[model samples]
Target: MPELTLEATSAIAVAFAAVMTVGFAARQQRWGPGLMVVGILGFLGIISFGIVTRL
Candidate 1:
């Protein structure tokens, strides 16, 4: 897969949050799953930022 640009990383984070919100509304899932997903995405974003700054 291609590497994600900063914009793509952030956009996906937002999109996942939105999807999770909708899922919550329907009582289809709990907070744990969404939290984990966003957590990992946020971590990646943070790591990328650090790498970019160091470059």
Candidate 2:
């Protein structure tokens, strides 16, 4: 197995977060899910930023 770099890991995390955000946004009937999506994106952003800074 090959070792994955920080960029690859960050890309996967962002993709997963984007999918969840879309799924939650599609419901359009609850504020909780929407807020969850925002939180997920925010967390991903912070993580990516940290990863980039370390590089």
Candidate 3:
């Protein structure tokens, strides 16, 4: 597996963090399930990216 460039990893990490923040905020505000889905997708995307990169 090739190492991820620092910039690419950071960008993805930042996006993941931002999505998590939105998820928590939405939960606090009693937003519907859609926001939750977005959050989950964001998290899973990061995980998938990591796995694919490592393979």
Candidate 4:
């Protein structure tokens, strides 16, 4: 099993925030649900990464 470093966790959080920001912008612009899907996938990916890193 592996442990996640603080830097890695911070980076992931930053990436998640960026994705959410983009999702919000897209929604405001009426860009359809594609960006929303991407945002959801991004979130899931972050969670998966955390789990994998912890193992």
Candidate 5:
């Protein structure tokens, strides 16, 4: 496997950080079922495949 460049790693890190930061807003609301399901799913999505998607 090819090693990740600084840019690539930064992209993933920034993406992950952005998602988590935004996810905080998903809390502190009348979420009712009040789950982080969407955030969790998005986080998982990034971790699993979002960063490496093809054009």
Candidate 6:
């Protein structure tokens, strides 16, 4: 199995951070579940990307 590259990890981390931040902000502003869904999907997508790329 190949080692996980820093570039790929960083991308996933950044995406996760962005999604969570937006989610928290939305929750604070009472934006409801729609925005929360966006954040959740974004987070899951990033996780999936990491798993698919990682060995």
Q: What overall lDDT goes with each candidate model? A: 0.66, 0.68, 0.72, 0.72, 0.58, 0.68
Give the poorly placed runs of model 2, Cα more than 4 Å off: 28-55
Model 4 pairs whose backbones collide: none
Best by TM-score: 4
lDDT of 4 by residue, 1-55 (tens): 5666879867876776776678777775666356667767877877787788766
Q: Which stretches of candidate 4 lie over 4 Å from their true place?
A: 28-55
Cα lDDT for residue 7, candidate 4: 93
Ranking by TM-score: 4, 3, 5, 6, 2, 1
> What's the CA error at residue 41 for candidate 3, in Å?
8.9
Worst 10 residues of 2 by lDDT: 1-10
The TM-scores, one per candidate, come to 0.45, 0.46, 0.51, 0.53, 0.48, 0.47
**Candidate 5, 1-55: lDDT as tens digits:** 3455668756876766665566566656656223445546655765566456432
Stretches off by above 4 angstroms in model 6 are 28-55
Residue-wise C-alpha lDDT for candidate 6, range 13-49, written one tens digit per residue: 6776676677677675766455667767777776676
Q: What does candidate 1 score on TM?
A: 0.45
Clashes of each: 0, 0, 0, 0, 0, 0
Cα deviation of 21, candidate 3, in Å: 0.6
Cα miss at 14, model 4 (Å)? Answer: 0.3
What's model 3's overall lDDT? 0.72
Q: 2 or 5: which has the higher TM-score?
A: 5
- What's the best-to-worst order under lDDT? 4, 3, 6, 2, 1, 5
